[model samples]
Target: MPHDIHIVTEAELRDIVTLDLALVDVIERAFAALSEGGVVMPPVLSMDLPQANGEVDVKTAFIPGVESFAIKVSPGFFDNPKIGLPSLNGLMILFSAKTGLVEAVFLDNGYLTDLRTAAAGAVAARQLAPAQVETAGVIGAGVQARLQIEAAHLVRPFSRVLVHARDAEKARACAADLGQRLGVEAEAVADPAALVAKSQLVVTTTPAREPVLMADWLHPGLHITAMGSDQEGKCEIEPAALSRADVYVCDRGSQCAERGELRAALAAGLWDRGTPPELGDVILGRATGRQSESDVTICDLTGTGVQDTAIAAHVRARFPGAGTVIRA
Candidate 1:
């Protein structure tokens, strides 16, 4: 007999969970599973709707350790701002790898996306960030940027947070929100350069098509997470910035090279697909991160399918009794 399908909502998983802690948890288990060599997650197939400026992505991941399989459908409406809607939306489905049975569904499209992306940041910090990174800086005062600050706080107990945005008032507001939430003072910087100067760890989570953080602003003993610009023609950090870093890492360097920050670096001849370690390799202990305190490290995250699978499983366990399940 065939069992019915289950659906879960974003509101049920969590409310205002900080990006750092949840992100770290997702990365730890995901990488550990990857290290064991039984997980296989190919690149996701995605398309964008021009008229709506929305994105639709499909991803599948296989994890043998948990005997689980998952697929996700997510969309992002960049024009949602003008439409007075949110910029992201999506859902996740977890299945039984053993019998190929669908098990749980997560209905929050953008929420899971943000959680996994932030978790990637925490994962990067655990392996690549400097030993004494007490200050954190975030560019783009959007929701993702706010979570970045919180996630880093979980990995490292930072004393100060610096935030920069296209709008001064928005940046200040974001900073104020973080300060109030974390009980740590967040300073709103006038520009990216100022935030980059004082903070050893920087996270960029904007939707800019051009570069936001410049190369000259970076210094040694610094680690950066570029979370925005996951698609083609989208870039947040300049190519020169990657060139300045001694180590460069990403969830998938090939995809990132084709679309994300890696694309810009390859174009400027600063680096290419042949360079840097995949974040999975580093987490698996197959590659080294931060050879010394003076070296610069960069983690460019374009997201992967495995993340969607893991988060779907997490959310499903919590919301099993709440969602509707009906046989098709």
Candidate 2:
């Protein structure tokens, strides 16, 4: 008899997992596993649909000794917002590592991606940001922009937040919403450079093809987490900004060189391959983090398959028997 396959819904995931320190720890462990050579992850499969302003990415990973692995399909239709639909959507397929059997399907509609990405930001902040941060900054007003700041607060106490967006109204609304939710002072800034100047830690979460944050505005004792630009031709920070950082890190150097911020820097001849250590190396004590209080650090995060695997495992652990097991 075949096992009954379990199907988990987005609503259920929302109820079970949250964007907090616990999730951050899970993501951190995933990075440590990667650095320790305990995970098998392949290059992401990506397809671009220029006419529709959309892109699709497929990612997967297997962690040694873990019961299950996950393959996630993520799609982003930038024009969806014009029709009142979400710009991002996706699901994960979980399989038993031992017997190659389908165990569950998480129809999370990209919730896990958002959760893990935010958690990754927090992990970066925890490892590189100054110990005391009163003000944090974000470059976009989308769902990720809000979540990154929320996650950062879990690691550092931020009393205020500054947000910069191309649309002034959207930035103001995002600031207001964040202020209400986190009970902190949140304000909108007209200039991205100004936001970078005022913040001790900054997160860029936009989908822009061009640079939004620049190097000239970056100051010492500041840390940046660039979470956008997971696809080709998308960039949030200028290549020069990366050059200015005393310590430059990436979630994965190979992936970033192909699609993340490092791609642009490498193209510009500003960065060398594998010059910066992977975030996992820092987390695993294989590399140093934040050597001095005045050191500037930048973390370029290109969404990784290990993160999907880790978050999937965590969700399964938290909600056992939530899915219907199906026979293979």
Candidate 3:
């Protein structure tokens, strides 16, 4: 038997998949499937290259009824900017669930990953952020920081945005870009605490090994989405902040405990709350979300393979079917 493998370029994928509400819904359904159980997702395979200031991660998931599944390979080199290259890049391979045959190769150059990750932040905001968010703050000036704010605005429209980063120049530039792009007030806040003080929603997108957002900065009606600590040894929020939140959620409790923010919290003996609710459960109404306007909620997103598969399948379905196809 022979099968056709479609080779999709980054341009083709970019044309099909944009970070919009529709893509967010696709990610949302992925989470719903995760909570309903029976989804076979393997633990992430991660490797750190200390000498190169880089890391690589491979992730995949098999949904019971989905026609295809995806395996994604992603690499991040923090010093890529020095060489005029992006810090992150990757591709995804989709295989037929029924036949275990190659279906497509998505050479997205990490664009899909970026979109899905940002959409996950939006999902967290939709379920956890306050009903009316007048001010939104993000603690990072990288690509994720910009996308996260845009994605969140799609769910909870904010009148202003505050940007904070360790680099003052980057923060100012990111703030200006966001303000012009979002058509809203945006400024760079020198202090993380000040940004949190005036924000109803705050997202941490830095790849910091130390805590960037502290427990003391948490205020009422605040929903924090920490998305940078997907790897071990990465900590964006203070360990104690997990315990301090009125309701702390994880994208996946088990994964979070091993590699996400929950890992740090557990090591510090701060996550004694025992089995925190996952984002999927909250989305499905199986658990609680922001109960009151004054509630402080936090969601720890470590990224998931299901998102990769979901987004890949979506692009395939929407594909023009004119890519380079190789039969195997």
Best candidate per TM-score, number?
A: 3
**lDDT of the candidates, in the order given:** 0.80, 0.90, 0.93
Judged by lDDT against the true structure, how good is candidate 1?
0.80
Query: How many residue pairs of model 1 clash at the backbone?
Result: 3
Candidate 1 residues lying further than 4 Å off, grouped into runs, are 15-23, 317-322, 325-328
lDDT tens readout by residue for model 2, 1-328: 5777889899988987898788899999999999899689999988888999998999999999778999999998999989999989999988889987888899999999999999999999999999989899999999999999999999988999999999999999999988998999999999888898889999999988889888888898999999998888889889988878988899998998888999999899887535679999999888888998889999999989999999998888778788555566
Q: After superposition, how far is residue 275 of candidate 1 from its true place, in Å?
A: 3.7
Task: Report RMSD (Å) for each prediction in the order shown.
Answer: 2.2, 1.6, 1.4
Task: Give model 3's TM-score versus the native structure.
Answer: 0.96
Cα deviation at 133, candidate 1, in Å, is 2.0
- On the 0 to 100 scale, the lDDT of residue 21 in model 1 is 61
Q: In model 2, how large is the Cα lDDT of residue 133?
A: 93
Off by over 4 Å in 3: 50-53, 320-322
Please write out the lDDT profile of model 3 over residues 104-176, one tens digit for every residue.
9999899989999999999999999999999999999999999999999999989999999999999999999
Candidate 1 local lDDT, 70-143, one digit each (tens): 78787878888897877777777788878888887767756877877788888888788988877899999988
| Worst-scoring 10-residue span by lDDT in model 3 | 314-323
